[model samples]
Target: MTTQRTETTTLWRPTGPEELALVAASGWRAWPPRLPEQPIFYPVLNEDYAIRIARDWNVPASGVGYVTRFEVETEFLARYPVRRAGGETILELWVPAEELDEFNRHLVGEIQVVREYR
Candidate 1:
């Protein structure tokens, strides 16, 4: 008998309360579609970056924030290049809004809330 292992890359997303609610409504299995004004869905490469956005940006804007962690097939992630938005630690995978449905299909498992800021 042979066993096969699936490789996955961990990603984190910083979300506000409203967005988190939609994710919950999906049963934590998928992210909601981006609004008309949201052109892209960027998931951070590291927890520190995600924490920074959730704590500093989301909290101030919405009074609450959450850091959600999830995994995606490593092979699928190779299609998108890692974008450095600022400093060395600021890395993200920018998934186009039009492709988000395909992105969600590549998720390895249910999204989980790893941290929260108020």
Candidate 2:
């Protein structure tokens, strides 16, 4: 007998940097069908981090860069697979592939905090 398998993946895009941070702030829902509430501190802190990066880098942000709007483009296994609870989705915004070097410069002053990323 043969078995079929499918992989799930979610694609999220923030309006800008702050929006990206906001989505990351939303803690990973460990439980499926019922995502429990988690600490808001990390999200808040991440928002702060994104904002500080914006200012220091002169990214020209109007308000908080928390992810305001996004949509799922495609999925790997599921029709629209969501992010794994507390997974790498959050990191995507931290180190955008487009502007990797620029983000690094903004992150230089934050070596201590970035230890988590490393």
Candidate 3:
């Protein structure tokens, strides 16, 4: 008998201190719910884009920023289309706020803090 390996898609997210705290509170297993004004939970496709956001955008806003890496089951990710928010390399998976809980359920492993900026 052969064992089948599960496919997973790696994703990166740039976040502030507050959000990182919440992620930690979940034991690094899930993301917190989006705020009222926040309509989407977007995880970028590349680490470079995540680094840029963490260093340039998030750090300035919160004094510190973090770049987190995580994996989601590729089959579940198929439901959401990749979105380009800016330049060509700015690719992301846009999971609607309402579907975030379901999205979290598809996470393949714990979210990791790959890099930090201050």
Stretches of candidate 2 off by over 4 Å are 1-4, 7-14, 28-58, 62-118
Pairs of residues at least 3 apart in sequence or in different chains that clash in candidate 1: none
lDDT of each: 0.96, 0.27, 0.96
> Against the correct fold, how does model 3 do in TM-score?
0.96
Candidate 1 TM-score over all chains jointly: 0.97
**TM-score for each prediction?**
0.97, 0.20, 0.96
* Predictions: Cα RMSD each: 0.8, 15.7, 1.0
- Model 3, position 64: C-alpha lDDT score: 98
Q: Which pairs clash in model 2?
A: 7-76, 7-77, 8-77, 18-65, 18-66, 19-65, 19-66, 19-67, 20-67
Which sections of candidate 1 miss by over 4 Å? none
Candidate 2 vs candidate 3: the TM-score winner is 3
Tens digit per residue, CA lDDT, model 2, 29-112: 111121244211121123333344444432444443222212211231122123233434332322223332332222211111
Give the best candidate by TM-score.
1
Q: Please provide, for model 1 over 14-110, each residue's C-alpha lDDT reduced to its tens digit, 9 standing for 90 to 100.
A: 9999999999999998989999999999999999999999999999999998999999999999999999999999999999999999999999889
Q: Give residue 88's error in model 3 in angstroms.
A: 1.4
List candidate 3 segments past 4 Å from native: none
The TM-score obtained by model 2 is 0.20
